[model samples]
Target: MNTLSSYKHDYGPLPSEVSSAIKPIYEELSKEELLERCAGGFTQNNTESLNQLIWKITSKILPAGSKIVEIAAFVAAGTFNEGVLDLLLFMHGMDLMLARNSHEYA
Candidate 1:
């Protein structure tokens, strides 16, 4: 089995599609706002908020299955948007709905 040390993670710049989507939003922000956002990056997405957001989504939206919900919690944590947690909430909700359908039908 593959181990953590052997895993090669591709930590590169965001894909063009993602960058493109955010370009408009980025441009719309004032220079001062952008600077403030940059300064706040380090303090934002704190451990407590991340934990609570993930817990609420995974525990409430995911199916009753332990494994699926656990995986969902982990995945949702990474993709969770500090600026807009609800967006990823919808994403987790979609995943849960899909999992529920497949799981129930299977």
Candidate 2:
């Protein structure tokens, strides 16, 4: 297993592709807007919002089951960083949990 340091050396930051994908939703927003939406404390609503956005984008381009992994690979290749992989995994897990909760509520 790659250590976090190795991962960091492997992947420096988010990739252009991932940034492009996420940009449509976030890029237009001002810095303050982003802070408003994502700041303060973690909440179910915020988590759901982030999950929904990622799911919407990932579903469009990735096959299923491996969307996050594929995205991580892309990020790793594009940025030579692995922390991005961890971030994607965490986001994916949040998306899954949000989806499950939405289903349960429905």
Each candidate: RMSD: 17.8, 18.9
Q: How far does residue 33 in candidate 2 sit from its true spot (Å)?
A: 28
Q: Which pairs clash in the backbone of model 2?
A: 10-80, 10-81, 11-80, 11-81, 11-82, 12-81
**What TM-score fits each model?**
0.26, 0.21
Q: List residue ranges in candidate 2 displaced over 4 A.
A: 1-44, 60-62, 67-106
Q: Per-residue lDDT for 1-106 in model 1, tens only?
A: 4995487657747877997998788777746766787785664556767677666766565456778667656665655643344445556676754455543433
Let me know the TM-score candidate 1 reaches against the reference structure.
Answer: 0.26
Best by TM-score: 1
Instruction: Name the lDDT of candidate 1.
Output: 0.63
* Candidate 2 lDDT over residue span 1-106, tens digit each: 6684355445637877886798677656646766687676653574465455455545556566785756644544433334334444555666754455543433
Error of 1 at 42 (Å): 14
